[model samples]
Target: MSLKYRDEREPIYTCDRVVHSETIQALEKDMQGVKISMQNRGLNVDVNKLSALIDGVRLDKDKIRDSLYENLHLKGKVNLNSARDIALILSSQLGVKLRKSRTGRYIANRRALTDFNNPVTQEISQYRNLERLLSTLKGLYTATDKKQGKVSCIYTDDCPSGRLYTRDYNLQGIPELGRTVIYADEGCTFILADYDSFELRIISALSHDKYFKDCWAKGLDMHKKAVSDMKGIPYELVTDKERKLGKMLGFGLSYGQEAAGLARNLRTSIHQAEKLIKAYKSNIPEIEAFKQETIEKARSTGFAETYFGRRRFLPDIISPNIVARKKSERQAVNTRIQGTAADIVKFSLVALHKAGFKIDTMLHDGILVTVPEGEVEDSIERIKVIMETELEGLKLIVSCKTGKWWSDCYAKPGRESSPK
Candidate 1:
């Protein structure tokens, strides 16, 4: 093994390539406080519950592994952790038509196989998910502070997405099923506040789209409305499945998803994906126009700006190479709402932190707070009010829930409690 260390004694100088913001100085420093609060607050988890969760996931993984072996005769034959081994099995044994890269090597990545219509693919995906869940649960237990029974997660803001990312025991990446064991502290309840359809609202706000704003104000289903308007069908005729397709087109095309990627995810042909994109664009041209405008401005300016005035300089936006330039254009479209959503979440975190709240964790567009049982109602009201404030002229809608555990907040809050 070899070790390389930074030369601490070397002279340091600012290269001056960074984009400095004059208005966001305090905001930048306060974002650090948000991270500090998360680290210091630690995490409250039920050790016994977490152990049970780990056991359940391991059991499920074992069952899936056994099924996969029985189906494929792979018992003691192949390493399940090795994608290449499974990919070989998929290509050679199962006769699945695996995709090849430009170099003619078989692509065995999850993205390549996740949408494949094979039972083995489903089994493998399930096994992998359960395996990861088991590992994450074990990591949480290992990272738990023995004396305090709190899991410590490390967060950093060096994310290209401009959001705080959790490392080590990555709480932000935890699935809903895995979060059930993360409970509120004794005598405390968890308050969850998230922007309703956050990225969609950001796109609408940025584009000054009156239709989406009206939908928000009237409490109408945005997806259903889009389908109704685009397909010339009654809103009531939009089935759950069709509305789901609408959601896919609405969100995906807004973020500049190409037809190939959409087709892969939708398990459909590229032509159908293109038609969906066309339908979405034809009916809701405001968002489409906004996306194009964002890319055009960034292509000319060599940078993208979020709603909160954060700038991400894209040197590739002006590149002479077509591939790099198009990729940069897609990134510019994504940066508009995603970057704004990140900033909005950070702003909410700072506001909540200043209002004397202990932030449990921050997800992409949500914040969790631990409040005393007596203060639950008041906390929810204050948090919703704080989080629902206007952002760049569009009203930010906040949805609040109180729960005993993190996962419970996903459903309607129904946790009963007594005062401490």
Candidate 2:
């Protein structure tokens, strides 16, 4: 018998061409528009409000430090801002036990702080949050394009996902608070559309998981359904908390989270985490098998390929070190899911751009398009159609929202509606 020969690199090259051609042009054009609009609507930070907030945080930190010193009857003025100093004070003066975190931040980690009610720990966490907020503000100030009056972010397409990464300013990683400062230009509105459970949908289609497919077909909330089935509760009776846990397990386990890591994330015991994993796997055993097969293939071939043929070299999979091998295995499994989702989004962007829509930003699984206020509805419908279109036989559920502000696009109630 003669074996058929096929060049695996052919499909990858084809995808590369698509990504590097019109898609790159579309992304660059849209990014330029976004940058100009942002510059015109330069983030208006209320300096007085920010100053007041910072001053209040400093005062609160001082009060907490003074209270601790008075109550504990400790020594000379200790630097509460210093984690090491706080740990020393707590351990030596107050006889409070302290544990070093994975990053060596003593008692500063939420996981290491056993007692949430501890005044000292609470104060430290609050101070840190405020400090982080201040640091973020400083970063934003530095990132702001002074001459252009806008924040200019660098976009890179070098990742295996083929997704555009906003570098330097990291607009993609901005926190909710940071996003509030961003506004849409006058006469233009933000139209945001994101794939719902994009990776899980891809996994379902790839694995042919009956349960997942049926849920997607029926438009049921998979997170709630999974929680209900796993916990033996009625779907309607499943609490938000339970559904959240189910979502965490459903997505986390699929991405190769170990029981211990899952437990740590859930703040539960490893046994409980293992049980949750087992229940989740039992519901979609095919996905588990698929993931294992993916890992094995990467281990054997020293690389993994996404559904769309994008290849990720995994040389560490063959490493003698167990930790490196395990990390590589996780990356191999995760890359397929993440990279495929990225490709799907990129494809949608290219399609939409070709259709004459103005894309403002390309998120990991979402696209934010700037449209005239009068054309918001039309734009939303068109975006939904483009985003939900089948890619490699996998269809996605796309949700869209329209607002005058970027934050409002996601924050407004009842703003999100799926276009059937």
Candidate 3:
């Protein structure tokens, strides 16, 4: 708990003991190189296709708006943009169960609607999704350079975690809708490689939880495996609904989700949520210990450090306010886990760019790069090798998919969205 370092040989995130100041500096420099490469080449997008997609989304949005009016039986009577109206309709009129804020008034935000199973709520979510999708992409058409047929974005270190954010068209937050507009050059293709179940693997790596590691070694779907373990059945027998609850259960606890939050996410009773969390923790007991130790360290140091020494200083870790202090505790856990995730991705990008790949943007856990049509097979292997980084005893897995368009992550043209 001492503030002084023991000659900087401490292993904070991973067992490799590589979280040093100089190592972090070198990686940041390499990330700059990759960013420059991305800016120089820009993103190749088909403006015409993007325009058509926007039209389609716009039409859908209009239909959803009308559908909302018809469903609520308040055609042209309520304002879609008004939270007050939506709250009244959902809470007072329809008597739908709604969550309230700390102030204890009925709310109509996304979190309030998370467990609302009404058709109107689903339509509302769809409408909002389309709205958000269009807002991010509609600006791209205007920002693109017509002569170059590409759009460039400025990267910044503005997020809490050290992940890079793209601006001036906000390429960093491209939603699923934006993927359909990606256009490659005539003789080139796009290669996308992402880490598989990256956060869970990182958790197992950090905690060295045996059962979790064993599951990963066998390449079992962790969600289904959890259900299998709980119900004493085979993995294949785990239903989709059970697997989904298992996913919510695992990740929910991993990121410090509480019983109430887990209940809301799973749409189950608080008792059931607690039972699931208890069962999950019984399976992987070490994760809780790791979280406690991580939070204690952050409390002692007043900051959280990622695997590579990226620090997020938390002034509220010791705050007098219980809510802020508890939130800071959660942030302490999340910053290290999620921050390490972002760092590994950047690490992969730095390695691949230095190995002479024409890198594009990073999509959370993956990278999209452009290579010659004939060099895809070779480049995929190279990217995977560089990306499947090694820790002390654990090696990461990288999945690659190539396509003519960014949305297309298929091996063959007619293939569905299945991984190869």
Per-residue lDDT tens digits of candidate 2, residues 1-420? Answer: 011112344422333343333333444455444444433433433343334545665576567667666777767876666778878877876587677768877754655654646766676666566666667756765776555446656667668645668776777887665555555566887778988888888887767678888887787889999999998999899999988988898788657789999988888899998988898889888888888898999989888776656667888998999999999989888877886677667667667766776666667888877788888888878777667766445567789877665667667586532111
Candidate 1, poorest ten consecutive residues by summed lDDT = 1-10
Candidate 3, 20-56: lDDT as tens digits: 3555556677788788888787888788777887888
What candidate 2 gets wrong by more than 4 Å, as runs, is 1-81, 101-107, 114-116, 146-148, 158-161, 412-420
Best first by TM-score, ranked: 1, 3, 2
- Tens digits of per-residue lDDT, candidate 1, 1-420, equal 011122334332221344534333345678777887788888787787778778888888999988888888765667776667877778776788777789877676667677686778878877777777787778888988766778878888675546678887788887676677778888988888888888888888778887888877888898999888878999999999989988887778657788998998888899998887887777556877888899899988888866555567799998899999988898898878897788778878888898899998988788889999999888888887778877557777888877777777786435433211
Off by over 4 Å in 1: 1-17, 90-94, 108-118, 412-420
Assess the local accuracy of residue 190 in candidate 3 as a C-alpha lDDT between 0 and 100: 87
lDDT of each: 0.77, 0.69, 0.77
Task: Give the best candidate by TM-score.
Answer: 1
lDDT of 2 at 48: 38
Candidate 3 lDDT score relative to the true structure: 0.77
State which candidate, 2 or 3, has the greater lDDT.
Answer: 3
